[model samples]
Target: MRKALALAATLGTLAMTRALMRDRHVPLPTALPGRRETLSAPQVGTVAYYASPEGSGRPILLIHSINAAASAYETRPLYLHYRENRPVYALDLPGFGFSDRSRRRYTPRLMADAIHAVAAEIRARHGGETIDAIALSLSCSYLAKACLARPADYATIGLISPTGFDGRLSGEGPPDGHRGREILRDVLDRPLIGPLLFSGLASKVSIRFFLEKTFGATKIDEGLLDYAYATAHQPGAEHAPYCFIAGHLFPTDSTLLYDRLKLPVWMVHGQRGDFVDYRLAPRFAERPNWRIDSLPTGALPQFERLRAVTDCYDGFLASIRPSSPRG
Candidate 1:
């Protein structure tokens, strides 16, 4: 019995040592390559955003997905192309990027509220009562909710590779209550381990591996890998992934809110996107006001096919007009 007990203890120690070693060598991304801007709003956490001052028209608010590599920088291709025609505002959602990280729980409601607060600030600065909002992946849920909560505040809504469309609506219980809730709580409560795991999932090597398997293309832009790595390693970035995995960074069922929304709604998704589910199109199509744009590219359509995505966005914007004149 003593010999068996000693062997088990030795194996446990070895396993722990291996985990610690792997963590120490984990490669993280650097800060996003761009100018950092801060926006302060009442009732919402201080928002960190990236902008290109070289554009015109009603400023467009771009919300990236909640992931380690997710940020306004991830949307750089779109921002660079669209900035000349419209001032682009890409924000690092509350707990991501350089934004506040003190909060322990992030929810779609909280994120939507943050978007509302940021919109208020943008209206104050740009003299516009309403703005065009674009969201990618997980961010789509939060932005959708924000638009639903106050339909008149947003002139148009854009969704890229959106989630939360499992033939359900917003406020519905998440699928796999036990597993999802446990994952959420584990991510939020265990900060250090959560970030490490999330970052590892988003690592360049991991991204490349997944891209090859999903897209059947191994030739990823080296610069993209570098950017992703650097952004994941930023000082507070370690906590951003945890918030995202916890599902507190974005709401899960904003699609159900679609029925109540009256704004021009456009959704774009890559057929081969990582988060793609057959249910997304059919679910959103059930709504009369929503329009869908399917891309032949991958989940990171902006990076995979920049010009095609830009052209699609430009055409969409041209087809719609602000419901009301800006102040």
Candidate 2:
């Protein structure tokens, strides 16, 4: 009895020490370097974003992946690379970066709605010209749903290392219905343990580890890591990330959405890292509106091979003629 009591006391002390050592968090502002904007979505509240000067034809929208440390920073290399040739905009989504990371249930519909709202705003800014859209990983589904809701808003869509193609590849598990990890999400969303668990996952060390894994290299982008750490350290930042961890953000019908896209689609994925199993790509083998490219790196390929990625994207843009401005 004494030994058990002593062990319990030690565990309690460790938990208290950890709680004390946990970083005191305040929200981080927009880390994306450019002209910024704040727009209000009906249900999503205020959204923070960045836009480059308009040039040439229709503007481009870049959506970052959904993850524990997601932000426009994920789209940094692509934004900078494309902004040079055309107008570029990067969104903070609804619960990330400089946006309103309020405590709410982060769902695919909410995220997709956010995308739709931003796309509408961009369309008005560009005199109703349809823009090109690109999304990384899970955002691809949200983007697809947004485009589906209003196909007239987008001219073409690009996806990078998106989910769903490897649904069958992940082996057997759970009753997710292909949408997300509800059981894990339920545990993380709990009041007492949720925040503590998230703080540990969002710590600078943890962020660095994930970033390195994302790049499929021991060395990762230090600047991005810094921004990710800052963003993750923000108050209420863990809400969306926890939702993501629970698979609440990954839409199960993403494959169906991809198949339903009438606009031209350009997809890219790498052969390395944690997210590379797109063996089901052959399913789209006969899709004239769909094109896929393979990279030699991991999930965030643009950071490692910017020139190649831009060149490929440029080729996709070249294939489509910019639509005439709506009368």
Candidate 3:
């Protein structure tokens, strides 16, 4: 009888596992705010974005962070705030959000090119006017690269909780040398287990856990979690996230770009969160073009202190004197 009981327990566990795996394989599309449009990026196929062109002068583009379940919704708080006063656009980077997430190797260069393509589309609509661009976390590197390549395309720049500047090895390795590449490659290329591993990482519970850690608070935004879970379950969502987890998204020369930037750069970060290490920021503290603000919240401070975030950013923009083309 005891032996039979053990057999029954093992079967029950296996059945539960199968049920969870089936659920992960099922796709679910998240309901995102704003009118969604697709840009034909030469390198990244179809890149999706949410645009609001109401009250406008120079447009503002908001780029969300890169992670296992990144989306335009991550910029919801800031997007809604900016759209009320200026033309605002939020991009769902390729391989994330509503963009094309077909199985492929996601790279930082691909992501940077997507930003450039989106900016070009915005410029065409706005009569070649340079727009203001902002990015969060790792996407900061991509935005920096984009601005560097096309300095004439951006009016001002904002970076929130940007990676690199940790005074440590957060972003010091060679751009091509990712320590976790071999492990991630095996995890993503192995038969059967590849999908299973992605499923485990993108499960609703796993996403929630990550958000809680990001917020560094028990009271994380529920709406963000709901959308994150939905987007994470979409078809091919794991492709980019696998690259991100393997540390392939960070650029090696991030600090060099930040130091060399001549346009007005506003950087706002927080004191609490898994990403609060800007000890090296003082190196550029006195730069005439760089404005740094430190807050008392987590990585996503805009979620809790929307007004503060916008006020500081807009203030920085207002202080900049419009100048001619640098090139």
Candidate 4:
């Protein structure tokens, strides 16, 4: 009993140390250039987005992936590229950036609604023209749900290194049906220890380590590293990340949404990195509206091979029509 008590005391001491060392105050910088806006959605708090101030063509929406330190910087390359000729916008998901980072139950449906709200804003700004939307990593699922909910709002859909199709297709379920690990959520939300654990995950070393895995190389983007570390240090930053860690943010089934999409779909992925799994992508190869392309870099291919990714994506955009039916 004495030894057990001693072990418990040691663990408690470590937990306290971590909690005490966690909070950081960093001024979050403006991620994109032109202009930023916010829209309130059902369930999702005030959602934030950035867009080109002036452009004269079909607008395109870019959604950054979800991670411990995700922001609009992830889609910087594409945003800048498209901003030259066409209107381009990037979103900072509900809890990640300058949006409402209040501690709440972040879920897939909420994220999809956030996207829907942003799409409505885009439609209002551009004479109600349908949008060309793209998403990286897990945001692809939210995009899918949004498109499924309002197919007419989107002209075409693009997925970059999307999840849910790594090995098999997603199973069918309601939009609210998620794969959240409630037990894990409770554990992570426990007093004191949760914040400490998130701090470690968002630490400089951990961010770079994950970035290396994302780039599949030791040389990662220094700017991204710097921004990620800065954003993770902001107040209330741990809320969404904790939900993600607890699996509350991912959809239970995205394959049905992907299959149901009849609008022109352009899917791109990189050959390198930890996310190079496109085994189930071929199932959609025969679909009349689905177009899949593979790049020669890591998960964040636009960072590694910007020109090539742009060329391929541009071709896909040029080939599609704005009124493409969602049959």
Q: Which stretches of candidate 4 lie over 4 Å from their true place?
A: 1-22, 168-175, 321-323
Point out where model 2 deviates above 4 Å.
Answer: 1-29, 168-186, 321-327
For 53-77, candidate 4 gives per-residue lDDT tens digits of 4878889999999999999999998
- Greater TM-score among 2 and 4 belongs to 4
Span of ten consecutive residues with least summed lDDT in model 4: 167-176
Give the top-scoring candidate (lDDT): 4
lDDT of 1 by residue, 1-327 (tens): 999999998897677645634543435432333456787765567888776645667888888776655556667677777776776777877766667755455566667778888777677777765788888877777787777777667788888877766443334555212113546666445534554565567667886676554443566556666665655555555555565555455443455555456777778777763555647567667554667877787677887888877777778777765452221
RMSD in Å for model 4: 2.9
lDDT of each: 0.66, 0.81, 0.81, 0.86
Pairs of residues clashing in candidate 4: none
Give candidate 1 regions above 4 Å deviation: 1-35, 167-171, 174-199, 210-216, 249-252, 286-288, 321-327
Q: What order do candidates take by TM-score, descending?
A: 4, 3, 2, 1
**lDDT for residue 121 in candidate 4, whole number 0-100:** 92
Best model per TM-score: 4
Would you estimate the TM-scores of all the predictions?
0.78, 0.87, 0.89, 0.92
In angstroms, give how far residue 137 of model 3 lies from its true place. 0.3
Candidate 3 residue-wise lDDT, 126-148, digit = tens: 99988999999888878887888
